[model samples]
Target: MILKKEHIQELKNKLLEKKEQLLKESNLSHSIIKELLTEPSYDEVDYAEVSSDSYNLNILREKQLVVLKEIEWALKKIENNTYGVCEMCDSPVGLKRLKVKPHARFCIECREAFEKEQKNSR
Candidate 1:
């Protein structure tokens, strides 16, 4: 089915909102890391806690970076008039799926197949 322009616009807006939120989180994570680096621990336990917190924050930031890239890709597809099309089969990704995941790169079938392939490869 052909996607309505209004629906596409709504998905675009959602993507933009999510992108902004992720960027804000990324900046906050950076500031937190900086703060963690500058603060000195008085004891070994305190130092260990700080190290753990920093490690977790870095992981979170890395995840956010991946999402940011996906959002950027989606926005670019929207600009190119290719939004909501599944990359694997060149089919509509469906409005429901797009609403749930604005950055989805594949349709449900393709996604499931891709996941199965990855699982089998492991």
Candidate 2:
């Protein structure tokens, strides 16, 4: 089904909001990384805690980067008038799914199948 203009606009708004939030988180993560680089002025236990926090922040930053890329791709799809369509099957991605995952590239069926294939491969 062809997506309504209002729905597309809504999706675009959601993507933009998510992009902004991710960027803010990324900036915070960078600052935390910089702080992590400072001299360890604490005991071994404290140092270990710092290291753990740094590792967690790094993982969070990596995840944000990935989501940011997906959001960018989604914005591009919106510009090209192809947002909300499954890349794998050329079908309309359900509105409910899109609401939950605005940057999704595949519909639920295709995504599940793809995930199953990946799992079987591993």
lDDT of each: 0.74, 0.74
> How high is the lDDT of residue 118 in model 1?
64
Candidate 1, run of 10 with poorest lDDT: 39-48
Backbone clash tally (model 1): 0
Top-scoring candidate (lDDT): 1
Angstrom error of the Cα, residue 89, model 1: value is: 0.6
lDDT of 1: 0.74
Q: What are the candidates' C-alpha RMSDs?
A: 10.6, 10.4
Report the lDDT tens digits of candidate 2 across residue range 24-48. 8678554554444332221111122
RMSD of 2: 10.4
Q: Write model 1 residue lDDT over 4-98, tens digit each, in one string.
A: 98998898899989977986878855455334332222111112233577787877775676676677788878888888899879999998999
Each candidate: how many clashes? Answer: 0, 0
Candidate 2: lDDT of 66? 63
